[model samples]
Target: MKNLVALLLLSLLYLHGTTSLAEDINSDAETLPAFCTSYKCPRYQLIKKYEKFEHRIYNATNWVTTSLKLDFLGIGLAKSFKRLLDYINGKNSEGLVMKMTVPVRIKVPRSDILSTNATMSFFVPPAVDTLPTPLNPDIYVEQLPEISVYVRSFGGYALNSDYEKQAKILVEELEALELSYNSSYGTAAGYNDPLTFFNRHNEVWYMAL
Candidate 1:
């Protein structure tokens, strides 16, 4: 099912054009730093760059997300991604089929090694006039407020270990610089499809305090 969903998303990408699904978003691509590979990404400003991390301010945007507790990151992400994908694939109150977005966001709270409270999210396109209610009980539309974050970017494919390693490095760098951040939680964002094999973009984020 995941593979099928990914194929469908790729098809959507081809049909809408690789860069954008809307003209308004395409106009701003040159002006702002794009975090996602294709389609529209959440609007953000690059505030500053540090030796090991970057500081950014992002505007609030709505997302379709699903809560999942990780017993294993791979399995958990698969489940959550599927649920969110289904929601955007005409499995909603209004049966909407929207363009796929990049940089899937996963929020995680600090906790045990194997298990943590986490939720996976996909950016909601501004083109969506009235966001449809999710048919799946586990999925919901959420709005994130504008916020500041300390971010670290890395290349290649990311898994549980990759994100954890990046987060550790990010935290260490922040503490060394005497930066203030919420130690309780952070997020990881991936800007590629599962089929994307090279030049994959990934980042771990720590919310600034």
Candidate 2:
């Protein structure tokens, strides 16, 4: 009888553990911020009111790379786009393909972004362009109207291991504020650098906000 009782307790414990894990995953998924909820996000505000840029779907596939200086983001993105094009053309089969929106929103603080000191997550974007049959030199950087996003700020840079910790903090904040969010929001990039930044660094977390 004692053995049976112990066995039953163990079963219950295992079930509880599985349930807890599932809950954590669900909670993380649901913590996604609203679209362009930032004061500094001009693109977000512009789209919110004017809808000047019609929403168009695009594709993207991102891989992890270290951005130790933050300055490399814009250039990195350009390279990534080049890679993405290569993949589409069957040049690189190792890369992944994904779908996202164009004119994607970016987030910084209400004050100067350099002073924001927050972890950022940006959307990996893809867009179609009208390059003449010969391909024009001026239509290189595709124009995308920006959208809105929700944001939660954090301090310090970190490695991949720190995602759960930061995500949990954002999750708690979202829940505390009773915000409505999507379950699809998940971690993409883990590191960012600022020294090479031509645009910004505090622009780190660009999830579905």
Best by lDDT: 1
Error of 2 at 85 (Å): 8.2
- Which residue pairs show collisions in model 1? none
User: Which numbered prediction scores highest in TM-score against the true structure?
Assistant: 1
lDDT of 2 by residue, 1-209 (tens): 00000011111122122211111111112212233221111222212211111111222332212111112123323433333233322222223333221212222222332322212222332221221121222112223344233333333443223434544554555556555444343322211222222321121122333
What are the RMSD figures for all models against the true structure?
6.0, 20.6
Off by over 4 Å in 2: 1-42, 46-82, 85-147, 187-209
